[model samples]
Target: MKTPLTLLGLVLLTAASCSHESLTRPAPPPGDSAERGRELARRLIIVDGHIDVPYRLQEKLSPEGEPTEDISQRTAGGDFDYPRAVEGGLDVPFMSIYIPAELQKTAGASKALADSLIDMVEKLARTSPDKFALARSVDEARRNTSEGKVSFAMGIENGSALEDSVANVAHFQKRGVRYITLTHSADNLLGDSSYAEGAHRWNGLSPLGKQVVAEMNRVGIMVDVSHLSDATIRQVLETSQQPVIASHSSCRHFTPGFERNLSDELIRAIAAKGGVVMISFGSGFLLQAAQDHEKRLREEAMAFIQQQGLTRESPEVRTFIENWLREHPFPRARVEDVADHIDHVVKLVGIDHVGLGSDFDGVGPTLPVGLEDVSRYPNLFRVLLERGYGEAELEKLASGNVFRVWRQVEATARP
Candidate 1:
């Protein structure tokens, strides 16, 4: 075996020998293939269909002027910060206007969240029009691309923002909100959530939920069925007058334990309706091991809060718990496993109906290791290529297909 010094001497000798005229070697095989992918990803309109930046901004700009509680700066630390987004090659991200599901049944739920989240996106676009602009159409998304600006679009995670009224769906569309998830954690006026604690049951969409779907289509808002019960998914697929979108969901085929994923039946229904299912990178929605591990961790976290007599409603208690979870975190899925979901969606619903939708801040610190944050998106591209996705298909998955769907839906909108 060569000693360290001897190895260094040999390497130096090789360098000296290379000065001879006959030194010839085919241009060292091109660098990381991800460069090509990354360049394309950067130049093209890359989008994560959902993120929770408003939660951070709202937490920061609260009227009380930053919490007086266990107030750490990171309470305002979100995964998709502006500088990090540029570094990650993300050109467009549907900033999620997520209203807690429980609030919808209350008095001012719809108007409050709708006004609040929409304002957040508007403010971000206003403060940095050089960096981002609110895109109401896919054409605008591409136009923003030419201007070197990120497209900031909106997706309502829970239809509770519609406030159980047929008119509010269009209200959001006027605010530049594009899609609406018909249900969330608990059943809203729209339908039941896949994760809501209950036995296997089915009521599909209520009369109002069906009206919401029709109204969403008429207003050009893509009907998003992410958190909906399977029955509700079927209803939206059948009722939607335009292409539907599962804004941030994965294939149940890839991650068996997660109820949040779309089944083969649901996948086919969505694609059959000319819709797209942007695959989610959340560990809970991707791999079985990652999901089970995360579920156990959440249970343990809940127990810890209980033992400590902490309450979510208490600012101090919530802050401590949030920081605690951020520090401890959850078991991570691998980048390759995250790509495995992309592969599953492609196989299940063709390359024309898949895109990336990493639930960055919304997943509660349960992202994969290589995908620890939005900055690691290049790793996902690299892993996808390694898994055999060609450039053409990868382009469709990154954002092209989503753009196409948006265009078709926008062009066909009655609004």
Candidate 2:
């Protein structure tokens, strides 16, 4: 029989062991936490409908005078790079083959620029086959995810690339162009742009624009209405045989009087047509304060250009503009503001019609504070999760909804 002291010693030893075990064992990940958001982001294949990688690179030519941007390695200057994309769970991202509205003035200029941007993306995939592949369809995107490779999908930001001919639509489709925003910052041959101040050349879709819409429907290219005027959006909805997408648009309710964002009526109409509105992450698109700030900056830039008698394209004007911008930077929107845009869409049309476009690389450094780069997607996911979004809703938001629309566009293409 042991003495009472021996029993007491044994009990203390057991207690110490228990304490040691408790200390050594990993604690359960914080409940409903950022870890959960990261896990969800990883498990879900994130298909960002718009990322302007091509246009971003087009402005910077290499010593060889080529726009050969090597994003296969971690890049310091842009919101997107291979490592950051993987970190953020971006499986497929649409590279915008953006043709600026000014390029539309010259015959065949838009088409030429579009072709070059497409070549840039193809070269990226060709050079970095180990890390990137081309995804021409939703199925291809899924295959890319399964193979653990990042996918490049192409989108045209201006329909002027069609060059006043409907056949160019099918030609671009052959080049892997998946969607085309009808117009950009200004009115073009296709239609009036939302930002075309006092230029409602075609109050809605031009007669040619209508034909372009039908041809896009026949060719299975998603019609992107993000930059179209309100009248144009309504016309596209009435004309297209299939669903359309606003590849990088936000809710106008949040930034009232901002024509770039879709109105509540447009949101409902898009949902009615079984389409999705991929929210843009640009600060100006998500908040009125940011929009107001941007307008003030634009005015300041114009005044400077006029005062200096310098053309807008002058290098000196650009330098002056950069200096002015540095002196008066726009206020950054918060991740909460992005959540509010998502929430507004959900409340207006429910979850199936919402997705993320982010406008990544295209939006510059003006992105919201916490949601600044590709690696920060989990931050948005956490915000949504905290707001009571479940796994299913997040899955749709990540890729499923956009995939469904892509498949539908494919299945229902008239030609």
Candidate with top lDDT is 2
Per-residue lDDT tens digits for candidate 1, residues 371-405, read: 87767788887766655566777778888888878
Task: List TM-score per model, in order.
Answer: 0.83, 0.91
Q: Can you tell me which runs of candidate 2 are displaced by over 4 Å?
A: 1-32
Q: What is the C-alpha RMSD of each candidate to the true structure, in Å?
A: 12.5, 15.8
lDDT of each: 0.70, 0.81
Model 2 clash count equals 0
Write down the lDDT that model 2 would get. Answer: 0.81
Tens-digit per-residue lDDT, 1-415, candidate 2: 0001111111100000000000112333348658888998888999898898887787788888686557888886888899999999899999988877777779989899899889989989998888999999998989988999999988999898998899999999999998999998788898998877665998999999999999999989999999899999999999998999999999887678988799999999999999999998877677776665656656666777678897666677557656766776666777777777888888888899999999887766667877788888999888777777878888999999999989998887776
lDDT of model 1 at position 413: 80
Report how far off residue 15 is in candidate 2 (Å). 56
RMSD of candidate 1 to true structure, Å: 12.5
